[model samples]
Target: MARSSTNQNVHSADDSSLDAGGARALRRGLQLLDALLDAGPEGLRVVELCRACALERATVHRLLATLQASGYVATAGRFRYVPGPRLGRAAAAPGQPNMAVRLQPVLARVSAAFGDAAFAIVRDGPHSHCIAREVGTHPVQVLVIQVGTRQPLGVGAAGLALLSALPDAQVQQIVAANAPHLAAYGGMTAERLHLLVRATRERGWSVIGNHATRNVLAVGMAVRDARGEPVAAISLASTLARMPRERQQLVARTMREALAPLAV
Candidate 1:
């Protein structure tokens, strides 16, 4: 009887501790939600939210994921978080298209011009997700990543473009966070990613090969939002034969011309 009573007491204590932890998480989530709301439509970057909420990056990232999953927070552009549909502040109107739909025409134009696959990717925390893709009429195409595919940021041309556009400090933080998963994608390491970022920044574009797909080459350009912040990236991919050094530069310039008039 004594042992049974002790077990019951321990279980109750454990339950109580769990309840306290859950309550704390709830409070932190609410705090992050409030911060997103306060930032208005332009939204706040992770760094900005960290500064405003006085929270650690990992904590803020976890809370934001929960909030985003619940639809109370949404990504505004590349790295900004705004109030989501649950808050009724960012709901789309009737017949209004989202970012992917709005970008389809641009993707089509790029693919048509190059006879290769064009892709658009957006940053989601430490990862990049393909939100749109268009295939050209080429006889042989390199369709490496499809829509809805997610991979660590800096692993491919489009992802690297997105990574390169972020602040240097945030970039370092993200690279460290994604270090463990880097080996799965072509043995990528943090140091290699840092070098890639430097090269991309210096070249004003990104070109990566044999990272996301074997023997495939891609050229990527970051698309800016209205505020001149990177919101997404566009990449054109083909075989190495098709994307020689000169052709890579040509593709980059084509993407730049195509995106000259639009902002996410």
Candidate 2:
């Protein structure tokens, strides 16, 4: 009976300690940590972190200081904070496959079905970077784009496809700001770009006619995540001389079908 009473008293004391330590600021700090973990290598700024986690600047700063001192985070410059080596080690220890790694098989299937080069690209500011690509089984193909290559957001089929997926106001802003570069690609004027975006939205895909290479045609569609926001774009490029109108439509349809199950 005495031992049972002692154990109950200890449990009560532990609960009280936990309740005392669970302040609002501490809860906010944990939220910020979760956001950082989700962001991966692309760190967040103080303002963005605070906005995303709904914490005040002062509270976040204090939390960051504590986390940094404990070696969980590393801050650079005046704004950016990324997970430190300890966090990265923990993340990599499980040896679980990442999204890009799992996506390789799907990309291969798309390339096999279309018989044209297929690319998966993610947006990075004014440019989009090719994260993965599967080369087609063609004798002569556009071999310039490789993994990690960055292209202007309005230059190639992949870029235009992604741009078209964005909201009209956002597309217009990007096009207007990039007007000078648009002139290089004939008929890529802001008005023309807007028209193309409208057409892409209507068609549920985008196509560019020999803009990058003389006789190459490209068709692409944006892939969205669970939030209905575009995470990346997949595209197929082939020589216009080889791919007839029917074949082009088939390729577009096949690509869309392949991506349908993965769509949000």
Candidate 3:
């Protein structure tokens, strides 16, 4: 009876290991899909796919084969893999709402209220990426950021807003690692950066003037998740001439009030 119970325990452990391995494989497959989605029509070579997905060549090849068999991806010229027609069809299908869809109404309202371009951005590793944007109806508008553009995480309002929401230790680590790029921007010295971050944290927003583009100014506030960690940010950008001191303060007040409900 003792031997039988021991064997059963061993079998259960082996099954658990297999299940974990299968989960990891599924996760890798999803990572491959994400890489393809981000690469768009350009697709990716096997080597590039492997590197992006952090998988071995053989593993990526096998997963690609499986994805191809399922009509979710396709290969071209024996080296590149891209999302197949089925995937595109799925993307074009009606009734599915993505993050952009959910955030559109809020962005529209903010843009209408502020009379400036408003954007929603998500952090992507060391960069912050614009996910959605609504341009202001004004004739003279600021149009520096577009959807899918990546910006360094220590320079702009959106980046600073998101960085300010991180834990102190993590923020320090990221700032240290990105010191070189930060230095290029001229206001990224450790002392200045820490001060800005602290102020952002205290006020729950960040503002910048013409750092990324000439004649443009921006203000951003962090959007936190349920656990109160920053998950995203919303920013409004306008021409500096149109956004003089009083107007800037008014816009910032309006934005802060409008975005308060979105915080965790």
Candidate 4:
């Protein structure tokens, strides 16, 4: 897990950076948000938060009160704060400049390699969303996925790669959560998903055939964030005839090369 980062609005240049009046308050407020983000879905109590952010109890309370009113934080208990519903609502909204725009060029490069469609997928809660895509120029284009398509985090090759990169405990948690929903997709069970995740880990990538979509095969690898966490992935999808085991390896290597510079 990422350490409770306090560098968001603080840790900048000294007093000359901004006007003296409300700057300190702003820094403290951002520190509070950072600490709360690190606490995860379970959240942290007022006392725990105070210790994490190194702020006074009263100041933490004041900030929490303000944050709650602004829909940035929500109380789990009398003194605990979890991320608010507004954050989730904002996440699915389409107006923001998103990963697809940044990755469009990279996706084009991957698609060009073998005339197979490519996708950029990002983890959103327990699902991996196709945020960007580039269609191959081949006569038979494999449109396995498109921008805004979403699948359970362990379902598709791209999603499985992302899931395999997560910790074991978190993997189990997601398995449990998605187990109930998997039946609707294809009678997929958590146990089956677990097996795929393990295989993906050993292979350092994921490959799927006739699973999510029949006759379509895909190769995927996770991309790490600055924190070294798998936040996204790139995938190449084509007909099964085009993506043999040897070709899968080749495509994966190509994906790594094309996406390496973009990860930064």
Candidate 5:
């Protein structure tokens, strides 16, 4: 009876300790979130938040992921954090159709036509962010991206298209800033991205194979705003067997035609 009582006491102590640890983690997460809210849409880099919150790098990354999953924090570029939609500050003004809303039909049409996943991506500073997505009728669905996912300036097909549209000087600056983050993605480096920029500009469309996902191929093209600046991009993603060289060209042309009348 005495031994049983002792074991119970030990278990109770462990439970208390775990509860305390959980509470501390929650408090730290809130601190990180507060830091992001103060940073606003302009956002703050992970290192900046680590300094501001006096937290370790790994801890800050974990907290940011938790907050982002809950819609409290959003990533802008590779590691930059911004206040998310849950904060109630919409990016759109009153009466202006949001870019996501305006592009939904376009994405749906592309997905339906190609029987693959289609995405709408926009330029967020030096990053490309997936703002909307559409899944096709194919039973074997490949969901590689979702809304709010952010990629470096030249990392993915959408990003490559966006980067290819920029002038040489601006591309150099953005590529330099994103260089360090590129290594994390398999075979992606600053030099390689510059090569992709050249090829994408020459082809008038970006083609990425097996980079974002194994054995998946994606074709992308930039959508110009009213001023003729490439402000956004659209991509069609399918298996390698589906996107042959000939099919890629055909899809690129179709994407250009579909997005021609889009105002923004």
Candidate 6:
């Protein structure tokens, strides 16, 4: 009886030690996730994460590996890490409905002003998901992207605007990831997308043609969250002839004005 009691005690102690170790690991992992969430889409490198979480490099790496494997975190480039598809999926559960409903008014105002179709899209991992759309009173409407449409980031004017707002390093990483699918869209290539990103940054808005839709031109501007992070994009689309250089500028300005009062 004495020997059996000693064995049981030893087993209980072993289990207790394991439970404590597991709990510590879970806490460290949660800390890393908190840091990533606060970082938003811009993400952070391993070193940055180490500093943010105040954890050892090896500990962060192990936790990140587990998170990445479970799809809670993703690599932005060779160095930086961002929230992954699983995290986005979790947010989508409570986020998509609110985002779609809230942006309807903003889309309506922008479309009403421009007399064209206005669309709102949010970044979903490497893709852009159209959550809301409003059609204007124009006789000839450009309905390129509809509500619920999903496309690779940088494929459409709205998506491109969001993409251009990301850091250049993250941009390259996304472009490279989307390279294989670019050919299906108007022969778009990594090189071409990079050029467009540069142009969009320089112009302070985004314009793309013959890509999302044939013979259609779209102008887009990014909508930022309170943190000034690009969270969504607003775009207006029209026929190529209706969106000449001068008209594009006017549309961009109109969108900016309409969105000025937007809280998000």
Backbone clashes in model 2, listed as residue pairs:
none
lDDT for each residue of candidate 1 in 1-264, tens digit (9 for 90 to 100): 999999999999999999999999998888888887777656788998889888999999999888989868866545778776567525546666766886788899999998999999877667788999999999999999999898888899999998999888668767887889898888889999999999999999999999888899899988887788887898999999898899998998888888987755
TM-score of each: 0.74, 0.62, 0.61, 0.67, 0.66, 0.72
Q: With candidate 3 superimposed using the best TM-score fit, by how many Å does residue 117's alpha carbon deviate from the native? A: 0.8
lDDT of 2 by residue, 149-261 (tens): 87556567777788888776456556665667766764457677777778888988888776556677777788777778775787778777767878767877887778777
Q: What lDDT would each prediction earn against the true structure? A: 0.86, 0.72, 0.75, 0.79, 0.82, 0.88
Look at candidate 4 and give me any clashing residue pairs: none
TM-score of 5: 0.66
lDDT of 3: 0.75
Using lDDT as the measure, the top candidate is 6
Whose lDDT is higher: candidate 2's or candidate 4's?
A: 4
- Candidate 1 lDDT (Cα, whole model)? 0.86
Tens-digit per-residue lDDT, 19-55, candidate 5:
9999999999888878877875557888999999999
Ranking by TM-score: 1, 6, 4, 5, 2, 3
Clash numbers, per candidate: 0, 0, 0, 0, 0, 0
Please give, for residues 1-264, the per-residue lDDT of candidate 4 as tens digits.
Answer: 233344532544444466664788788888887887888855678898889889999999898888878877765423457676456456654764556676788889989988988888876556677888888989998887788897778778888898899888667766776777786655678888999898999988998767778888899899886678776788889898888889999998888888778743
Please state the error at residue 33 of candidate 5 in Å. 21
Best by TM-score: 1
Query: What clash pairs does model 6 have?
Result: none
Q: Model 6 segments beyond 4 Å from truth?
A: 1-35, 38-81, 84-97
Per-residue CA lDDT of model 6 for 1-264, tens digit only, reads 999999999999999999999999999999999999999767898899999989999999999999989989877655678887678658764444566676788889878887999999987667788989999999999999788898889989999999999887678888887889999989899999999999999999999999978899999999887788887898999999888999999989988887788776
Off by over 4 Å in 5: 1-93
